[model samples]
Target chain A: MDVWNILEYCAWALAVLFGGHMLIDLARVDSTYDNDLLTSSREGEIELTQELHKL
Target chain B: MTLSSAEPTVQAQASTQGGERLQLLRVLGPGHVWALGVGIVLVGEYMGWNFAVGKGGMIAGLVACWLAGLLYTCVAMIDSEVTSTVAAAGGQYAQAKHIVGPLMAFNVGLFLVMAYTMLEAANAITIGFLLDTVAGLQGHSGLHQPPFIVLTVVFLAWLNYRGVLATLTFNLVITAIAFLAIILLFVSVQLGASHVPLDFSAISTDPLPYGWLGILAALHFGLWYYLGIEGTCQAAEEVRSPARSLPYGTMAGIMTLLIAATLTWYVCSGLIPWEYLGQAGTPLFDAARVTGSTPLMVLLFIGTIFSTLASANGCINDASRAWFSMGRDRYLPSWFGAVHPKYRTPYRSIVFLVPIALIFALGAPLDQVVTFSILSGLLGYTFMTFNMVMFRRKWPLGTIKRGYVHPFHPFPAILLLLICAATYFAVFLGYGSQLIAMMCFYILASLWFHFWRYRFVRRGDQFTMPWPRPQGC
Candidate 1:
């Protein structure tokens, strides 16, 4: 109805989009990745081997 | 230095190189570390620290600043040393895990999660309130706060979910802008560029309006000046060189906050009366308005927005890292431990915490939320003193290769403990009931962990760092 209302609607649209994407991604990863690997004490040590980009 | 000796650290290294198991990207450097630490804290300089002036007076605020500054100096020194060695995502929680035991680490993890999450909620609500204030000034009333609040959380969560480097780089830019605004305001006032008359006489004449007891009360608010600076250590795992980057960035972060906090106090104390300043919502923005300079007013307005956004963003980063670390160790569901295949971010932890932050931002009482966050931080700092003492006794000097060895260890540990005890009294003086309530909550959580969650934790495997067994062991 008004500019403030329009802004509020736009925010709602963005929140739903972002929040929804996160949830769907969560489900996809849970389905795809091995549970043992996910819960392991180890993580990928790619940076330990070589120099990465600086600041 | 030998990655081969660290079973899990080495396994982690091998898996990422050989396999497709996603992990957090390691692209950050010292600048990102400084940005993460300072971005979470500079928001306090914008508004919260002036509450000390309200508690006692201008002089009491100054005293609290120095005393808290001393406390955090000890924190920065000890944290840099421990974090460099731990070199993990969880920061203090990792230290708690290695130096103490499972129970302490679990509680420390909860402390990190609760502290950062509540602060995130506080920041989101502040953004809402700040925009609402502006709208009211513009003759628009009844502006809804939830849309803005939710937008802030979700947008920042999205930024965090995408990548760590971009999120922190964004934090660095905005945090620098906010810090510069404080410097500009301070220099302009000091140079008499602002014709607004300021009285320095009240600072001396009525320095202690409420006497010595007021100084004790002010210590609690004094924490606002340098709160969360040690959070730089949370980026330890992501940084290129933990030894070099962690210490350098964290020390630089504390130095920056000390300068920013003092300038903020000096500017506002001289510009506004202590009576009103203690209660001002956006004190720096208020100070700019008092100058009758529109350009200055607009700059401060932008600074407030940037600081609030940066704080919320940093909170998301720290909280998710702590949560993801816990999940990996089976402290929570391993489900939350998954790194996104594409983004290399801890997507689940970041996403899950968003709703929790939204709830508090939307419905919780402001004072209760802030008090809980502050108490959690105090408990974490108290844990740190013991951590440092135990770290030295268990490992001793020269036993481990620390990135930055903190000199005069027993002194810093002792000083930190004493300051923590005094600050607890300050909390009790005003927030006695809330303090008790928070203790009960932590106790209940600890009991739950001991009885139920300990079963899931990999006791020996949690010690993933490659170090010689402790001297006492």
Candidate 2:
């Protein structure tokens, strides 16, 4: 294989690895809207307001 | 600043004031935010950055991408800091208002709206171009029909107004498909033996076709690869935990784009001659054609369509939110802030932006559309970095509970500002007419804000910075 071929192989490998890592991370996270953060509307607003003040 | 401690005080204050609340549904998480960020710029990796190669050849293009990547990395880090801290739906506009003042906020907000709307229009035009090319209508002058562009704008805007959850879900699915298509393209090229091997020796002689000047000229196309990642930051309020999700999602999105950009440049350039690849409108599709696989070309074309639609969808969501934020603050008509009662989305703002985008999409050339988007986007970026520096000065370390503090404080912000300014100048020199047109738009926006919008804002106590002021400031 030529140098360019080897480089292409490495690039593909890295791309797969990065894509895999991102997908795994996405899968592992709790992305549902059922948390206290989203369900309790009034409380969530207050919490966000407080967070803004802290900044 | 303990979460438990601060909650009671805020609740007590809220009880006393009893004000109308924001109607935006909080259904997004890191996944959605990441998807939005990736979706906004994913189309660039598929097509636009090849223009960099036309200007500076392959080597210069790669160098430009690397440099632009560094600048965007800094911008993303600072974005995480500000978005997490403020956690506002308005994104940079809110940050600007709190850090600088109302005028800067107005400019940033308008610039963001312009940037995203222009990007949406550009994507719509690209879809038209891609479809024409796929149908063997490449030489057909009548392919860019205005009705088709208007239809695309209307469809995406309707999708955006449906609901936040539905819009984000659609974005996530299309973004995933686009990424997969890119991987498939890379694999197809690697496995196929139809193309000539990349000539590294040619880099020394042929890559610098326009000498050093070409590298500078290529900066804006290089930037196209990562331009809209900050749009993800606009989802801060909708994100489940802005403090956590904003930083992680946006930074992760940037990393993904960096990898995608590098792979797209390397694999595609390796598959075809850089000179020819640079001038092609649909470089990835052409690269697939080089593999001599008709099926691969079809697959890549579908991917192109999905990527463009995903970008337009994400831009519609982002631009509407920005307009809603301005309207809610009374910067524009209060009509823009009205949420759909059933869907709990900013239907008015979404609908308002559609015709504006359609008009631009129908009237402007594709290259001009993209340039306008980039110019406005760079202006917003410069202001955002400026806001970051001011934010750091206003709230020193330990003054606030920062979810993700960028390590260098003001340095990253300063570096980003310089990079944005330099790229803006480069783009102005390279594309003077578009920049001049953008300047005229900016001047008109400023006049409207100062003369009309400012008066409306002054007439009410409704406009207030969401963040607490620094002591004695």
Q: Chain B vs. true chain B: TM-score for each candidate?
A: 0.96, 0.91
* Global lDDT of each candidate: 0.85, 0.76
How would you encode candidate 2's per-residue C-alpha lDDT over B302-343 as one tens digit per residue? 888889999999999999889988887778876566555335
For model 1, the superposed segments whose C-alpha errors exceed 4 Å read A37-55, B1-20
Q: What's the CA error at residue B244 for candidate 1, in Å?
A: 0.8
- Colliding pairs, model 1: none
Model 1 lDDT tens row, B387-409: 99899999887776777789997
TM-score of each: 0.94, 0.84
CAPRI category for model 2: incorrect
Individual DockQ of the candidates?
0.32, 0.05
- Candidate 1 has what TM-score? 0.94
